[model samples]
Target: MLLVKKKGQGVKYGYQFLRMRYIIMADILFEDIFGVKDIDFGGKKFLRVSRIFCESESFKMELLLDVNTQIYPMELGDKFRLKICTTLREDGKPDTGEFNQHDAGPSRADQFEYVMYGQVYRIEGDESSATDTASTLSAYVSFGGLLMRLKGDANNLHGFKVDSNVYLLMKKLAF
Candidate 1:
């Protein structure tokens, strides 16, 4: 969700309308983590990883994986694909501390955090094609074009696009 901050507004009434952009892709990768050695907030500990390559954009991201779970096989040359729904922080700030305090508790300080809800689609081997790699991976699939066709709106304002392919993928993941 994209949050627009109102000018001349006090902290009580600081933020205005939220514009949400939703992209339905198969999977996302936790490229790198850097800055802020350890993150402990919202009852979860996050290890900040830097130099994340999200599709075409390289961003500094934090992966909130299980603290006990070690990031395996994510080496310098390892390649994998993931499906994820990514969004900018809601307070128009990269740092979570910039937002107003919530009754829930302390907010995270990371600019953005992704909730990994999907599974690993493919693991790249030495023979994998770098150019058409995303398309070749089942997890990196995109539902944008299919969403436009099914809804006939040509714009994906809602969260997801439903189609036969989506159903098929969902079914496959279910089992």
Candidate 2:
């Protein structure tokens, strides 16, 4: 609910009587605004894990890849490529009249799934970043030009380390 107070709308003020009004609304989740996707509208990007830092339970992964203003995979470093595709927009929306679902590329079934394979460059866990207690644990994985942050329990992220091969599986919630 939202409440607005007028200049004279107070209990001390008499008639014209003061009135208090409220506007009610439902809560919204963050995922609704940014839907998950694998290959975004921008052209494909190949990246290498450059650095990884863990602060308490939260971990940050850095990658060496191209950066595009149309889409942001992660916090781009000195390395970066931009391939503009007329069919799709930065937000993953088709460019209306110019977009053709069937063109030249992988089929929808093949590209619909979200899976990324990469070698972990480095990893720091609770022991290195925590002093007292740990809260939420997170893992950041990058695929080409895409970046994904996963939050959950730390036990599930076992075996991730420097030069270790890792597979990140994600679900496409929206087109």
Candidate 3:
């Protein structure tokens, strides 16, 4: 349960009343609302690929992601919900890490328009923030060379691990 100050309802004084709201635990490893800050199309170096810079809406995380523009295109100012997960199975079971037909059953991927399977290759703490041991960390993953670097607080990125397989799900937010 998260003790969050209820919005618009407060105590007798000027303080906001603390309200209890339960968070349901699920297979979501990490989720965030991100806005595309800028895009660097690795022109000629990687045709049909764009290196997009994004910043989180709430957590303020920074992301440098390379996407295959030929398959999934993202333009400037595009806001999307990104979720990294361990499985696409609806039952929360571990994925076999194999490309399988989606006809077996309903999947978490069913609700997502874009999905990619990737493996975490690196995770490191920010040496600049050495005073605060777990201040910030970066996780790098690769989906067949399309790379992603997620940098944020260690607490918010606890579930990530080097060599762990993960699925990236994304859906554009309609604003």
Best by TM-score: 3
TM-score of each predicted structure versus truth: 0.17, 0.29, 0.80
What would the per-residue lDDT of candidate 3 be over residues 1-175, giving only the tens digit for each residue?
3243456774333222222111113457789999999899444357798899999989999999988889889999999999898888776666665656765688878888889898999999899998976599999999989899999998888989899888999888999
> Clashes in each model (backbone N, CA, C under 3 Å)?
12, 2, 0
The TM-score of candidate 3 is 0.80
Superposed Cα deviation of residue 5, candidate 1 (Å): 55
* Winner of 1 and 3 under TM-score: 3
lDDT of 1 by residue, 55-138 (tens): 212332222222212422122222232223332233323333233546334322132222222223222222344554322212
RMSD of 1: 18.0
User: Candidate 3: global Cα-lDDT?
Assistant: 0.83
Candidate 2 lDDT tens digits, 23-114: 10111001111222223225443453322211111232222222232333433211211111212222332334443657534422243233
Select the stronger candidate by TM-score from 2 and 3: 3
lDDT of every model, 2 decimals: 0.25, 0.32, 0.83
- Sort by TM-score, best first: 3, 2, 1
Clashing pairs in 2: 66-80, 66-81
Could you tell me the lDDT of residue 72 within candidate 3? Answer: 86
